[model samples]
Target: MNTPQSMMLGWGSLVVAAGVSFYYAKKTINERRAVQESMGQRPSEKLDCASFLLFLHCL
Candidate 1:
């Protein structure tokens, strides 16, 4: 064929960029899941404590 090395370099760069993007995307999703789990627990725990305190105060 004998076209150009620049075309090959451009394709290689695109592949590397895609790999990096996929890695960061996985990491971000994992972090979000962990945060959502922790945030989901906090409010119920606080409500439980508040309800217990109110029950004792009623006596």
Candidate 2:
């Protein structure tokens, strides 16, 4: 493929991957929030920086 075509293909692939990643991340967050609600926890509770980091690490 020519340089411009290859570059377009590369950028398109990156955009698609990013879109899929964002979709899944949002879905996972929603699922987790539901689980928290089911467990009697408030999903709307705010976490401090360290706690937020720990939560992400646990994931």
Candidate 3:
């Protein structure tokens, strides 16, 4: 009984962490794009996407 409960709790925390990371990554990517656009540079959507994947892999 205690084992299952502990396992579930661990899994729940892991899922929550992943969700938070994804959210932050998107927010960061958007902010960077906005800044670059404002500065008159052509924002690379592919770079943003690749960075996001790299972030996930590092985690």
Candidate 4:
């Protein structure tokens, strides 16, 4: 692909990956919160953005 097309494709892939990661992270946080609530414990804070970004980097 030409330079502009390559750049666009790269960015598009990154956006899709980030969206998928965020979806899974949110789902996991909700599940964990539910488990904590069921056990009479308080729900912890949501996962931090830095951690989420690191996760994306690893993928």
Best by lDDT: 2
- Candidate 2 residues lying further than 4 Å off, grouped into runs, are 43-59
Model 1 lDDT tens row, 1-59: 54579878888899999999999999998788778778884342335788899989999
Provide the lowest-lDDT 10-residue window in model 3.
Answer: 42-51
Sorting all predicted structures by lDDT, with the top scorer first, yields 2, 4, 3, 1
**Per-prediction count of colliding residue pairs?**
0, 0, 0, 0
If candidate 1 were superposed on the true structure by all CA atoms, what would the RMSD be?
12.8
For model 3 the local lDDT of residue 58 reads 100
- What digit string (tens of lDDT, one per residue) describes model 4 on residues 1-59? 46998999999999999999999999999899899888979745667899889989999
Estimate the TM-score for candidate 3. Answer: 0.62
- Among these predicted structures, which one has the highest TM-score? 4
Give the winner by lDDT: 1 or 4: 4
lDDT of 2 by residue, 24-49 (tens): 99999999998988998865677899
Q: Model 3: residues >4 Å from true position, as ranges?
A: 43-59
Better of 2 and 4 by TM-score: 4
lDDT of 3: 0.89
RMSD of each: 12.8, 5.2, 8.7, 10.3
Candidate 3 clashing pairs, residues 3+ apart or interchain: none
The better-scoring model by lDDT among 1 and 2 is 2
